[model samples]
Target chain A: MVPIYYYLILSAILFSIGVGAFLIKRNIISVFMSIELMLNAVNLTFVAFAHHWHQVSGQIFVFFVMVVAAAEAAVGLAIIIAIFRTRATLDVDRIDLMKL
Target chain B: MHLVLFFIFGGLCVAGALNLLFQRHPINAALSLIVVMSSLAVLYLLLGAEFLAAAQVIVYSGAIMVLFTFVIMLLNAGREDRTHGSKAAYLVGIPGAAALFATLVYIFLSYRTPLGDAGLGNYLVTTTDLSKVLFRDLLLPFEVTSVLILVAVLGAVVLARKEH
Candidate 1:
């Protein structure tokens, strides 16, 4: 039987990869993808614990997390589009309007 | 059998995540994200969270990922040559990520919490049970989530509209 620790380890690895990609990638889209990766890692952990505890609460929480994730994706992508339209570039370095 | 299925879906999830990280094209990454989401749905099923499994598929694979793909398509963002980051960024990020991963693994390994031996048994809640609890006890959170979704929809429309 696969132990629960395996799932936790996998989630941790994936989360770190997402964080690394988000930090190092210059493209806005890549960064967004990394964010999705991070969210997925969290979902994996939630489901794993839900299974471990034999309770439905964690699964219900996963449902709520998914709802928020969908909302985030919609709003975040729209913002990305708006930024791209004005700058004509998705590279993070070129987005300097916020720099002071 | 359960272990085999777990390995299969887990492999799929890891592959999809790696592809998302390595792929240069945003659309390809978005599609890979869908694969990851679907595999997670499978994981949810394995965990006996049937409702959550279905919800994961519908919300993530069907709705959220499609939204991402559409945005990528609308933007028509083409693949660019791999953008090089400064040496400092990679130097810091690589080690930082590695350290974080190591720490997490160590903590997970060292934690000695005994797994509950009761198993799921007869306590597994059916969809009806889930609905009852959701409506009866968790009604406020459910309604708040709906409102959040509505706000997100409005914000997305406003952000995407072309300014006059």
Candidate 2:
């Protein structure tokens, strides 16, 4: 049996990488993927804690998270398509027409 | 045995995530993310969440990644042109991320409270237990998610279709 901390630590590291990429990456798609990465890392932590505490609620929560993620991905990708159609580019820096 | 399994899948997860972070092309990054999700599913399996393992693979790696790839292709996004982010990102992001990770690890490791010998066992999370909990305790959230998905679908259609 592995200590639950190992899973927790792994989740933390994955989350940090996601955050770093989220800030550093310039592409909107990459940034979106980074958000998914962050979500996944959190889900891993929930599952680990659920295992440690012997609770089913955490897994159920993960299910909900996945459902929301699917919906978010759909809307987000559609928005990205819309933005690209208008701006003709995917670089986050160039889509600044909305900037005040 | 558990240690080896943990190291293998965990290493795969971390490696795939890092690759996704650094990959230049969205498709490459998307593929790498698929690897990460698959590894995460394996970790869930090791942790005794069989249903979640299945869901992680089906919903995340399968459906979500496919959606991302479709968008990537539809957008015809080329390799990203490197742009200078805010100075704070270059100056503080890496350090902040490292600090956050280190802090989390430290907090988890310092919990000397006995976890009471909880071993990873299969029955800890089965499909029946998961569904029962979801229907019994989490029913409202499930129905709300359905509504959210409907809204998302409508929004996607309205947003992505050609504007007259």
Candidate 3:
């Protein structure tokens, strides 16, 4: 048996890594992957708590999160493609047309 | 047994995440993300969510990652140029993430007594049980996600279509 805190600590570490990568990475696709990593860390926490509480709803919520992630990925990649078409670069720092 | 498996897969997950950060190319980072996703699926199995383990592998590692790789290849994404961006991101972002991680760890450890330990053979959630709750209690959200997926598909097609 592993302590529940272990699962939680691992999730926290993964999430922090995801956040750091999201902030640090210049590539749009890599940034998106970091977002997915954050989502995965949260899903791990949900499953752990679900096991702790003996609730099916937690797992159900994970399913919904996965659903939403899929939809988000589809649209997000499409937008990335559109952005690439215009900018001709995947670097986030350079995609600053909105900056004043 | 469960603890050993947890440590192993959990180590794999962290290693993959670090690889994702250090990798210079988007394709390499994408592959590292697959490693992370697959290891996470194993961890889900450890947590007794068998169906979620399966779903994590299929939906996340199998489908979503493939889409990411396809996009990477389609766009010919290259190795990222290592130019340092604005000073604010480095000064704020790294420390912010570290602070958040430390805070979460401190909170979890301080409340350790209430969390208890998770072991195998305690509450293994099977697919049938999951389906029952999802189909019966969560039917509306389930159906709404279908519409959401439909809308996402239409949006993707429209957004990615060739323009004159």
Question: Could you tell me every candidate's TM-score relative to the true structure?
Answer: 0.91, 0.95, 0.97
* i-RMSD values for every candidate model: 2.4, 1.6, 0.9
> Which 10 consecutive residues of model 2 chain A have the lowest summed lDDT?
A91-100
TM-score ranking from best to worst? 3, 2, 1
* DockQ metric, candidate 1: 0.61
TM-score of chain B of each: 0.87, 0.90, 0.96
Candidate 1 residue B25 C-alpha distance from true site, Å: 1.6
lDDT of each: 0.80, 0.87, 0.93
Predicted structure 3: lDDT: 0.93
The TM-score of candidate 3 is 0.97
Model 2 residue B86 lDDT score? 44
* Candidate No. with top TM-score: 3
Ordered from best to worst lDDT, the candidate numbers read 3, 2, 1
Residue pairs clashing in model 3 are none
Measured by DockQ, the strongest candidate is 3
Quote the lDDT for A3 in model 1: 69
Docking class of 3: high
lDDT of 3 at B122: 86
Q: Who is ahead in TM-score, 1 or 3?
A: 3
Candidate 1 lDDT over B1-164, as tens digits, reads 66788789889988888887778788888888889889988877776677887888888889887878887788887884554563556788778988999999998887635633213232354788678878999999999999999999999999989999
- Residues B1-97, candidate 2, lDDT per residue (tens digit)? 7778889999999999999877889999999999999999989998899999998999999999999998888788778876676456757878888
